[model samples]
Target: MSSQKEKTSPFMAKAIEAALSAKSITSPNPWVGALLEHQGQIINVSSTKKYGAAHAEAQTLQGKHLPEGTLYTTLEPCVAFEGKRTEPCTQIIIKSGIKKVVIGIEDPDPRVKGRGIIQLREAGIEVQIGDGADEITRLLRPYIKHRQTGLPYVIAKFAASIDGKIATKTGASQWITGEKARDTAHHQRAWVDGILIGSGTAISDDPSLTARPKNLSPEQFTQPLRIVLDGSGKLPVNSKILQPTGTIIATSPKSEKNWQDSLTEQGAQIIICEPSQNGSGINLEQLLQVLGSRSILSLWVEGGSQILGSFFSQNLIDELWAFIAPIIIGGDGLSAISTTGTSTLAEVPHLREIVIEKLEQDFLIRGFTGNWAP
Candidate 1:
């Protein structure tokens, strides 16, 4: 018998590539891709177009008549359900005369779960599951986490020197990493559903926080939502983040009404969150839930120490990406994470599945926290 990799890896890779083509544009919906094959030859490959548009399976099998063959998808075909915008992909496949269906993983949404697989099998179609499961799971992690926990997958990203300093005592932080790493950072900013920073970073850096990947036109990339954690609403009215249309300022009720109103006039939406139990800032968990309710599947946190500390202390961070440069700023400089609430080495949080990649003069250290994967 042929091994599973020999049978499904190539097709699944193609499907995943197709899915990534639309990943940035599909939010609140998983980026899915499908490939239709006849005999040993491939017929067509398609991916999700946009939010609320036709899914990958439907896009692949619709309006096409082909010989009985196999269908490979990065995600389980969705079944018909209430509130779904389009026809169920299972029905479409059954009518398309496809003989076999190979799926990457089951849909995590409660509405679909394993129902799509059952629907296919009941129609007398051969079904194969778990091909390319690991890769597909990583690709759909944000969507899976959102559906499973009603919380966006949180990723904390920062750049620091070899000695673990983010900036000097004077707060100058420009050009910490090389050009290649900075380019990669911009690409990451474009990939997530939202990009977040604390008010301190906003006031000190005065960053626009826009994703401008090198050589890519604005039309080619969708700008992720800009979010700021400002419990006191102390963000300056002239801050660049406030100029964006999709900016959200998470503040506490104690914030000044005039400051909130001024930011509102500048196209920023103010979300009032309860103060943390320690009375230090707004509740991070509550803010995450609010983002999840708004269909934010992934959140990228670019910090200025205090915000990173809050997230790490609350154990709200799922993944971390640290870009380490070759230079050292010594102990007097600001650290990447202000506090981790650990008094001993044993108490420090550990990362799993660590991956390190060299980018010019910088090294990117990435890992998942707790039981989180990918």
Candidate 2:
């Protein structure tokens, strides 16, 4: 008999392709795809739907009665666990009369981990793993990061001049990049679960922080949640971000109650975070934990130096997107990133797998930080 790996390879590719179709639509839950095959013929293919809905396997097998077949899934089928919102996919697959199962990767979630595979095996179902694990891992990076670290996958984005300055000495930073780069940035904003900025950016830019890509209609994409890191609660109550219902203000315990209440009155949620050990700002890790608990799997950080520096200092950033304009700003201009306390070249975070793209006259440089892959 041929190895199970060989039998599963062809189906895993189709399964991964199906999963990619649901990208950016499923948050908190990993976007998974399922395919059912019988006698070398494709039966059905399904991908995950919206959050809090049926999983890929359940969607594919539910309400169907068929002969024994092989089921290919991008992720391990989930078993019933406490606090689970939906029915377990493992049970659904067993009931659907699937005799063999092919999984791309085991879920990193502690709740299900290897238990789902064990359950299938106990039911006398043939299980095989691998083939498209790397692709699935890349697609589920945010979800896996959240499950393992209790922190959202962070992507830092910024626009700077050729001289690496974000703003002129006078703090004029309106149109650093061309319209094409800005539009691409908006599309990225729509892909993430949240958009974050420090208080300095909040005060200086006063941006609306909404994802409004010109090519996408309002109904086609939902606006990401806006988050402001205001340790001292200095963000003005009238800031454009505060006008949105999904805005969150992360403040330190020292913040004024009146200011927090005023922000709350504006329909923004206020989360009290512990102060950092350096006494500079609210604890970023703690704030990330809160975001993870709330099911924010991915976050985009549009910074004003300090926030970018903080995330770099803590090694929290997974990816970096830098848009460099052709113009040059003088030495007196503000730098794109503040001091990160790196005294040596080796201490500086080096990005890998660098990719460059041209957005009209501007150039976009994208890379992964640390051990991040994709």
Candidate 3:
């Protein structure tokens, strides 16, 4: 169905591809470019490809002759920018004398949530917002979410063998996936705002918890916030995750004051929140809401199976990034995800099958997590 639509609407496909490529562009600006079409021909195309660079409208309008009234563009023009370089795009669209506005998707940034459409419509521009444009426009979700909510999109990473073991009987699980998968996982961290883990795993395994991208220089790693979901507040004093980046300890009131005080003295920020009934400490759901407040766009929960299982039980996980290792662990160990009670897919959230990328000796399977809506 999508193929047929793309076949008929070449402009949408090309614009979507451009938007996809623009995701890597840095800055306060979400990567956006404009393509001017006249009689089905893209006469001029401009993108905000670089930071402090020309914007989509500026690039498209640069000295290039424009046909009097060709359809404006496929991408919804960005109306407002808080950055120093530019003015609102709504004025540009208005000045363009464009009689029609065709927007792929509405902006998700809370600031401009629907203001672009409103501005265009107020100017009497014919606005068409959804013409097979959702998937393309959603590429801007992370950026808009970051701007509006001040946090990156949180995606939890997990791994397991065919038998659902994150590690072997000894829990000496290393290289569950090959270099390719591991590299991809690190890359995912680069895209996200931060990474999250449980204090239990932090104390038990003492993992570095920095989901670094491939080949990053030691200085470039700029590890994201290391979050430990320790309700009882029992993270080891010398756990290594606290040594490097900013460490946030989400604990409950029950956590020994001395333990929290010790963490505070060790250069850790302590957030004392209510614990859920399971008593994992710090309300996991509220913790995410707080991270959103702190501009931790995406939270990567990389932990032992039990930690992930708890998030699943708490219904806090939004997405799953799984690196399925080629090797098999036959021994009894933790499953990649352990639900709280005896539950099936039926009892819990609805999960959507997304895509799988084969990397090294493992398969990186990513999926959208939600309750079975159907």
* lDDT scores in order: 0.88, 0.86, 0.67
- Tell me the spans in candidate 3 whose CA falls farther than 4 Å from its real position: 1-8, 22-33, 38-75, 78-86, 96-100, 109-111, 124-126, 137-153, 215-223, 257-267, 341-350, 372-374
Task: Please give, for residues 198-227, the per-residue lDDT of candidate 3 as tens digits.
Answer: 765677678877766667654443356778
Judging by TM-score, tell me the better candidate of 1 and 2: 1
Cα lDDT of model 2 by residue, 156-273, tens digit: 9999999999989988899999999999999989878999999988998899999888878765555789999999989888898887575999999899999999999999999999
TM-score of each: 0.95, 0.90, 0.78
Best lDDT among the predictions, by candidate number: 1
Best-performing candidate as measured by TM-score: 1
Candidate 2 lDDT score relative to the true structure: 0.86
Give the per-residue lDDT digits (tens) of candidate 1, residues 126-216: 9998887877777788999999889999999999999988989888899799999999899888889999999999999989998988876
- Give the residue spans of candidate 1 off by over 4 A: 1-8, 371-374
